[model samples]
Target: MSQSNALIIPGLKVALVPCPALGDTTLLLRLAWRLQAAGACVTVASVSLASVRSYLPGLNIVGGAPDVVALAASNDLVICAIDWQVTVPLSNVAYLAGKKLPRGFNPEQPPVLLAGRVIAGAHNVICRDPKAGKTMVQWIDLYAEEVLGLDTSLPVTGLQDLPAVAEDADRRVAIFPTTPHASKNFSSSGFRRLARCLTARGWLVEFVGIPAEQQKLKAEYPGCTVRTFTDLKGLVDFLSNCAVVISNDSGGGHLGSLLGLRTFTITRRRGDFTWRPGFNELNRVINPILSFKWMGRTVWRPFIPLRRIVRALADVKVQ
Candidate 1:
């Protein structure tokens, strides 16, 4: 392990640089909490820090990329969760923050990690770039167990639901169809059919997302309720009361998982087999397409079979 990876005590500051994804933020937040419990002050550096800043307290939140050396020099340690952030041009974080980066920090070698429990463990050597085939959370879990000496079995990363109110007293099934990327979403038609089917089965279905999306979904099924939230708090409260949540492989799904709701996430990423299969069984990630190269694209068209999704979801007895 490189010297920079060593955890110094009395002033250990861990900067968890995460990808802009909600899953990345959600899982890394657990690591941040664990580090905090272990007495190290942790900060989460992300472009979307504002969205998550409320969930994290006592820890610093940095926006955009800062000089790793300057970041590390100020704190006792810095943990890079996003793999590319550690490479050159991102400020050569491989070099222990004070001096030049050593060879063990090289990309080809196993992660040069800090041993002992002085601070949290980061996958500096064995970092998973692209984070394609595995649950990103599991990778962080490994770091927590091997480097931080913390118990990985406990669930530490869950986001809380706001205080109960009369509006949220009647919980219903939520369907979040809109995603930032079109490729990650199911056809509106699929959701329409699923919503009708669920409501037919006596489930109170509610659709949440942008105003336009809510309008569109409502048009498809007049029986189901369609709602939109203006802020994160509204979204959290609505999701917190949901008996079951079916969402795209986007922030909504991550939020549902963070709320510990029974969620079924539709995804196209093939790496799920490595992490989500047996361990993360509650957060069911349904992806029909494993891998395909078509027309110069690594992952070809993603078409989630809605009937199978309904069947899988039917197995879950929602509370």
Candidate 2:
């Protein structure tokens, strides 16, 4: 808590609805931590409710799109992410805008119908399109300073503290080989290579994914432990005991980083650097070997070699 707590109104209750994605929801945890530190009671709602609750058990969490008007009435302030597509009034409500609208949501006419689909009439709107250039963390810092009257910088802290289960906790390493976007994932063979290397050194390697991905992961990494979590609490509890986590550019890396675990993120391109996990000092981003524009979009080819990833992991003395 580098910033002075005086800037925020003590005991002010706030309700927040973050964007739909798990990664997007986790990015707001920093802001929630700051608010809680200042004695402000914070409630967060997201599609990833179970995951959020697992990461920060201290905060009040609800599921799905809550009634904004009802929340605004109960809480002192309501901060809704613009991606929710809910029209809210300007009074006592602020909007946290994200990168853009959901994909494939285009109106026939920009001026007439666009106004209906977008979130407007908010007294304060942070992270709008003009502000999208900054990284999500940078946007949150700005929100704290300009909106909440906090210090320019603050020490990064996990929303909750998790104690290691036992002496063998450091011997465990969890690898997440899946991402919502297929292109963003590191190669399956690459993860297998890294897992085998770690296993040879007596490090216990495990693979985690959703229930839908469980069978595929088990088949891909035979002879290795594959644990599928129906609930995020189970997944997070499992991760808390692990020493390190390796993941593609997805929610798993973000969750591990939020839990203060050493995380290695495999990103598809250098451009995705802005979205890399950053809460923990041990967090690192691994990018592809080369990237070039193919058609209208950039194509990141041939994920980074296994040797380089291994070298990066070795750089950190995780014990």
Question: Which 10 residues in a row give candidate 2 its minimum summed lDDT?
Answer: 107-116
User: Which residue pairs in candidate 1 collide?
Assistant: 95-101, 111-125, 111-126, 112-125, 133-271
Off by over 4 Å in 2: 1-7, 50-58, 88-90, 101-135, 152-164, 292-303, 315-319
Tell me the tens digit of each residue's lDDT in model 1 across 66-168: 5565665565456654443434333213221111234455542434333333232233433344344655556556666676555555545345335464443
How many clashes in each candidate? 5, 0
Can you give the lDDT of residue 169 in candidate 1? 30
Residue 267 CA error for candidate 1 (Å)? 3.8
All predictions: root-mean-square deviation over Cα? Answer: 6.5, 5.9
TM-score of 2: 0.80
Work out the TM-score per prediction: 0.68, 0.80
Best-fitting candidate, scored by TM-score: 2
